[model samples]
Structure formats: structure tokens, C-alpha cells
Target: MHRGVREFIRWVEAHRDDAEIQLNPPATTSDIAALEQMLGGPIPADLRFVLTRFNGGVLPAGELLPAGIEPGTIGHTVREYAEAVGGDFLDTELLLPFHKTPEGSLLAFDRSAGPVSDTWPVVDYYQDLDEHRLMYRTFDGWCRVCVAEWTSDDFGADFTLETYLRSGQRHAEVEPDVATAHATVAHALKRSGRPADSLAAYLQAARCVPPLPWCDWEALKIAAILDDEASAREAATRLASYAPAARWAQRETSPGRVAEVLGPIVRRSGDPKPLLRLLEQLKAQADEEEGPVVEAILEALHAGKDLPPVRPLREQSVVPHVPDVDAWWEASQAAYAEGRLRDDDLLLDPDMVRLGRLRPFAELLHIRRGF
Candidate 1:
């Protein structure tokens, strides 16, 4: 076995737990190194990371070949062609470079073609010249198949492997169900009006259908239309809670909805205590999960305007102990100090600090205040 083949086998063996390995006899170390040098920068950290994790090697039979091709035939062809050409043609026919996309589609670029050559061998070389021009054009069909298979396995069913095989286009199709659901919810919410009863009905209607991208934005719009202060406050609180619950449904959900829903409520209520409390709870959740939902809530809070001052619960008031209260308190103070806490920090009682520490220093404060 060649040194390259041995190194490839060892790499594949290490990644045996992952997808099956496919063999490509033509990809050489020198070729890869040269390509990297030409790019004038390291390949993305992620690509290198996957390569190291999987190691490297020839894929198993029927494993890394393209969706509909036979791996045995691919291997046989390469060997027969190599023997016929007395191995000298190996440099031109065997060496293939692969480029993988984030969506897990792979394209094989034939480096043997002088860089000045006009003709390329992409899946769709000329059908849509401008778009497909950048696609991977492998020297051999087998190399293309091998790359496509590797990419499909990495991305799994989420990637559109067939699209690449049929036409080198990577357009993602939007599901109709999501579009219709969003439209239905948006229309229902927009038509509903003011009174608490009407608003409640509207909210219920909005909740009936799962939020999709279109309706996700509409949900905030409906929340924004609240006319009564109390109604708006309730809507805001409900919307904040709803964001997390409906997150999975909104494929394209953005954090801005949280702010859009809460902005009106905070401005109309005159008291920012509820918003602050909500923010605190969200911050706690963020610490625990560190997910998109929490990040969005933090962003929304940061962008809100005209928020009322947060009144301290009370001096010496017994407050319920929350997990990581000290850390939460410190973070809250930092946010307040940075002016990200809005004007609401004032609503927090200096006494609340005592609850965390269980010390009564009211007398010391009174002395300072000239009481």
C-alpha cells in the first residue's frame, strides 16, 4: 500500500464510529497543501476540525459514493484506468480536491486543469453559467460522487443531496404549511380589537395556530396594537412567556419580537417593576440554558425605551431565595451600572440586598441619610 493510502486508512479507522469511510486514491497530501497555500489562508477551523475528528481514509464500498452510484464500479474504473495509463496519468486523472458547504453538499474541483483553463466540470456547467460557475468541478465523475456522499452523510437528511445530484443548485424550499399558518394567525390577530375580552379572544386565536415565520412577526404586531394600559401590560407579559413556548414553531423567529411586544406595555404601564422582574427571571433562565431564547430576551430588554424605574421590593423585606441569587444580583447590578438596566433599577429596594445577605444594616444607612 502507498504511504498516502496507509495514512488515509489510519485516519478512517479512528473515525469508524462515525460514517463509513470512502476511498479516493487520487487526493494526495501535496495537492491539499498546495491548494491551502493558494487560498492564502487556513481553511475554516470547522473544516479542519471535522477532518481531524474523522481522520482520513477511503470510504467503505457503497458508502461515500454519490447517492445513486455503485462504489465497486467506481473503484474498478479507477484501477483499470490507472493500469492502462501506466500510472503516469494518475497525476492528471486521480488528483481531485473537494469543497464542502455548510449545508453539507460537496463539490469536487479538478486541480489538474491548468488554472487558466476555461472549461470546468461542475454538475451544471452551463445551464445557469453564472450560478453554477463556482461549483466544484472534479477531474473524474467518481471523485464528484465521493465528495457528494461525504457531504450528505455529514449533513444527514437535513441537507438536500438529490438537488446537488440533479442540478448543482442549493435553493431551499419553504414549506407551505409554515407560510399558511403564519398568514392565518396574522390576519386573525390584526382583525381583533380593544376591550379586554376582545384582546383575550385575539390572543387565544393567535395561540390556536402554531407561529410560523410570517405569524411570528405578526404576533408582535398584534401585541403592539393594545390600546389599554392594563391590557397592554397583560399582553406584554403573556407575549414574553409565549416567546419561549412558541419558539420551536417559529423557524425564523428573531429576538426583536420580545421587544416589540413589551415596548408598548412598558411605556403605557408607568411602572417597570413587572418588566424588571421578567428580565430577572429571563436572566436566570439564560444562566441555566444559554440558548437563543434567553439571548433574545436579553436583547429585547436592552432595546426597550421609556421603561419606568424598578422600585426596590422593600428594605429588610424577606424575598424568596432563587438559585444563584448572588450571581444573578451581581449581573443585575452590572447591567444597571452600565445603564442597560433601564431606569428600572431604582424600583429594586436596597433592602433586597439584605435578603440575599441576611444582615440588617438599616441603622448604618439611616446615619448616612441623616435620619
Candidate 2:
């Protein structure tokens, strides 16, 4: 185990009783086994250890602790309550935990929702809930949490929710340049009401940095609306270069738009080479089984009479072919006797010369061609 993981484990054990409110010692091994079967994987190691320690009893039951109390406030130890919750805590980006009511309702405290009772259950037994509105985390990261409304062997109504802890926080602290650029572009776009010409300019400015999702399409749509053919072409080409999978360029109808927007540029440019190259890339990508936008590119390429040959590339190898095992063995023995073979080389053609059975070069030569 890593040093950090070990230290965290020690801290969790020290505060197990206090940090986990409504604590109860875990059920027997059989019960745990059953829960594991239900969850489809082993419960995380740290979480397993915590449940084992607190399963049978409650510590601070019926009282909600403040945000960050469970993990951040437990102790100064690097691991503490945070580590005890296991990888899931970090993966989910949990800002706070929901308190389950006696009536089996789930509630969370959102300052954005305005003043409500201290206990605010998000879902009530009588009210229908929006599954997409319920946020949850996964082992990979915060994703739409899919909860099954009805359990079947195959499929169920899975719920998705937002990650409460915002993304890009670490980037802001660690990569100030990138964060600043993104913030600047975002602010500009917001203030400008997303004008097409302004968006095109911003796209050029932000091309070297990581993109915000859907930013390219927003720029492209703006360019098209403004009827700036050159700007639209630039936006399309850039979008194709950076993210061919983006939905705007991926639609089957997208090629018509690309050709309409970029056709004039293709005609007027000194050389058709750049346009041809872009067409080839789009065509090659379209041939793949994935991405609808590739198909759109294919349509555009065909429309422009710019499609390139789609034949696969072939390369030649130097190794000669031997017809059968007997011929291969005789050739191999001659090569070994001539000191042309090494242990590694012999291993490469095991059928011709088994590694252990092959004699040393000198002995093999003495026995063979009279060395």
C-alpha cells in the first residue's frame, strides 16, 4: 500500500465512532456478502473497514452535522474520515451527504434553494421525482447516478444527478494560465451575447487551449447566422480538427452546412490541397463505425468532388517464408552452426529450433560442417 493510503487508514480507525453519524456495526459476513452481490462489486476497502467498525451502533443519530464535518473536520491526520469513506468519496466529489428521514425520504441542504427546514428531503413518498435532477457519483467521477426503479435481470430506470463539487477547481489552482484563458473567453462570450463574429474571433484566440464542451458548435452556429462564409469555414475546419465527434459537425445534415459555408473558400483559395486534405480526413473518419459527423463530412466531400482514394495502405516485410517444419529445421541448424543465431533468435522460431535442444554454436559447428 502507498504511504498516504496507510496513514489515511490509521486516521479513519481513530475517529470511526465519531465521524460516521448514525453509525451501526456492519452485519455478519453473510449479510455483507449479500450486499456485495447486490452492488455488483466488492464495497471499497476503506468503506468496508468503516462499516465493520460502526455497523451495529449509532453515534450521532438523528442530528445533521455541518457540511465538511464528516471528512474535513474529523482530524488533522491526512487520511482521517475522508480516507475512511474510500475512493468513492473523492470519485463522487461529494460536497455533503444527504440525510435520510425516518419516512425513507432523502434530503439535501442547498443554499440556492432558499431557506427551508433544517431537514430537507429531496424526495417525498407522495411526490414524483425527476431522476435526472438527482445527482450522484461513480468510481470514475461524478456522472449521472442511475438508480433502478424496478429491478430486473437486464435493464432498469437509472437516475443521473450532478456532482455538487464543481469541476475545474484543481485546474484553477494548478494551471492558472489555462484557467484564466477559459474564464476570459467565457466572460467575453457571456457579455457579448455570443455574437457570431465575436465567437469566431474567440475560437481563434482559444484554439491552443483545452476547449469547453460545445464551445466550438456555439461559435460555428454564430458564424453561420452572421453569413460570414470565411468565418464559418474556419470554425468548421477548427471544429473538425479539434473535435470531430462534436454533435454539430456529426449530424448527417452537417455536411450540407459545411459545404455551403466553406465552398466559396475552397474555390477561391490558391490551392485546393488544404481543402482536399480536410476532405480526406473527414472521409477516413466517416468510414469508421463510429461518429455521425464523419458521415456528414463524407457527404460534404462528395459534394465538393474532393474525395480522395480510400484504398488501405500496405507495407512489405523482409522475413522469408519456409514451406514446412523439416525445411525450416535444416535451415535453422545451418544458421546456428554458422554462429548466425543467438538464444533470443532461436527462441523466435521455436518450431525450427527449440531453445533447450539447440547445442552451442561451436559444438553444433564441430558436429556439422567439420569446424
Candidate 3:
């Protein structure tokens, strides 16, 4: 057996006491042979070893699909998913699905990568987007991540703020240039009740390439809460510069949206003139609806009155197309209330909260996926 496979099994055995994890009996040799015949090729040696020992069952992060079609083996689903994909995104014949993630995606082996099945890479097939995302270079590589995730209680009931923070740091170390990792770390710190550290992390994220406006927005809020005037000013300035290009700015309510954030800063600064100048510049380039909103802010500034209150902004989920997320959140809340889960684990389970897995690599850096 491969080292990664051995390590994974050891970890699974170590945590076998957890009620949420289940390891079925090993696959019979004949069943394994039948599976290979069905695939029209030999299986990866490491995978065959895993099947021989544990067959397939549930893990915290995802389900290990069994071989030989015992209700959850994904026999026809593979071909159906491939057929749905239709395009040149994948080679239908060589795709062998082995795992099903909580997000309803399949982790499949792309057998066309090389002659040896062991060298084939694993790819995550997203049903919603009809896309295949390369997840690991080899089956063992995926096992390595699984071992790490399971060993550290990632996606497990014991998940905590520290777990999230450590995961974020690991991702940042792997992809230093990706702003999302730093942002995830910042959010984790915020949840840990460390506003100062969170603000610093957000600032660090904002300095990354293509500087995320969400990072600046969050930093601005934290600075305000921390009563750090210098940091607040810096965040506000960046937000102002990004206002024109902001997605929400294109709407008719753009001016009010801008005012909601900028107004508070202006009020706090006790200098409305600078904001007025910025509004005037925006007005020159603004559309008809946008001009009126800018004018409203200017009117309030000139009269030294409070800016009109706009609807409070709500932070939206970075995860997309998960319609039943509210139910997931309610479950987390119930679990936390019942003492079955930690406060941090309430909404950070990679198995429960869809955003949990994406945060480290993608979600936190952008308002929406693929943006």
C-alpha cells in the first residue's frame, strides 16, 4: 500500500470512535475484479488497497463511494454526469468517480492523464456548473489531504476557530498571492473576538493583487469598531476609489449605497468638504438616478446635517446556488444550542456549510463565485 493510503487508514482508525464516521468492511477480491472490469481498465493500486481494507463509507467531509454498486456506488451517475457535461471538459470513458463531497460534487479519477492508473489525477466534478476542477495530482495526493483534514478535525464535530485559522494559514502558505486565504484568516480571527488582528489581516488581504473591495469594506468596519482613525481613513479611501467599479454601484441605488458607508466616515471625520468634493466628481460621471443620490449627500453636507439613512447593508453569502442553506444554518444553530457542536463549528463545518471548504481557496476574496 502507498504511504498516503496507510496514513489515511491510520487516521480513520484513530477516529473510528466518532459516531459520524463509518468504515464499511473491505471489498471482496471478486467485487474488486468486477469493478475493474466495469471500468474497462485496472484501478489505481492505492485505491484497490483502500477498497480491500475499508470498501467505502462515510467520512466527515464526504462519502467514500463503495465499489460494486451497493446503493451508493455511483454506477450510472458517473455516465449521466459525464453525459450532462457533454463538452470537451472531460473524457467520459476514463472518468472513475470514487468520492462524493458534501456539496454534491463527485471526486473522480481522470484516468487519461497517464498510462499507469496510479499516476491519474483526481478531479472534482461540479454538477451545478457542469465543470471539472482538478483537485489533486494523484490519488495519494487526495489521500494526503483527507488524512490532514480528518486528523485535524476539519469538517468534523470538533471544528473550532483555531481549526479554521490554521486551515486559512495553510492555504495562504500554499497560495501566497491569493487574497482569499488572508481574508479567511481575517474572518476566523474576527470570530475569535480579535478585531485588531482581523483588521490587520483584512488589510494584508487588500494589499494582494487586484485588491478585493470586500477586504477594504471589512477593514473599514473593523477600524471603526476599534476606534482607529488612521486605519479607518485608509480603508474609506480605498472604498471610495472602488465605488465606481463596485457591482452594487451600477444599480439605481448606487448613491445611497455609497452614502451608507462613506457618510459615517465623513461624520466621524468632522470634515464634510472632502466627501463633498468626491461626490461632485462622482456626480459629473453619474447617471440620472445616480446624480440625484449624490446630490442628496451633497445637500446634507452643505447644511451640516446627518446624511439620510439608507437601508442597512447585509453581507451576502459567498457560496452560490445552495438554496437550502438556510436549513443548514438552522441545523448548525440547533447543534450549537444543544451543545452538540462548538460555537465556531456552528457554521464552519465543511460538510455542513458549503462555504466552509471554499473560504480558504476562493469565497472570501470575491463577493460572488467566479467574479
- Which candidate leads the pack in lDDT? 3
Candidate 3 lDDT by residue in tens digits, 1-371: 77777998888778778888898899897777766665666778998888887888898768988777434664445556556767332343557888999889889987767778877777778878765645665677677667666655455555566887887776565445556668888888766656678888888877876445567767765665455666766665555553454443322234344454455556667555666565565566556756676677677877878666443223332222254766554554444334453322213223533433232211222211110
Scanning candidate 1 in windows of ten residues, the lowest lDDT window is: 362-371
Model 1: runs farther than 4 Å from truth? 1-202, 209-217, 242-252, 282-371
lDDT (10s digit) by residue, model 1, range 90-125: 344332223333333333333344543223333221
lDDT at residue 198 of model 1 (Cα atoms): 30
Local distance difference test, per candidate? 0.36, 0.36, 0.63
Which digits, one per residue and each the tens of the lDDT, describe model 2 over residues 130-177? 111222211111101111101122222231111111122222332333
Give candidate 1's error at residue 279 in angstroms.
3.2
lDDT of 3: 0.63
lDDT of 2: 0.36
- Scored against the true structure, residue 178 in model 2 reaches a CA lDDT of 41
- Model 3 segments more than 4 A misplaced: 1-60, 64-99, 103-146, 153-180, 205-213, 229-255, 267-290, 298-306, 311-371
For model 3, the run of ten residues with the poorest summed lDDT: 362-371
Candidate 3's TM-score: 0.47
Query: Model 2: how far is 325 from its true place, Å?
Result: 82
Query: Model 2 TM-score?
Result: 0.30
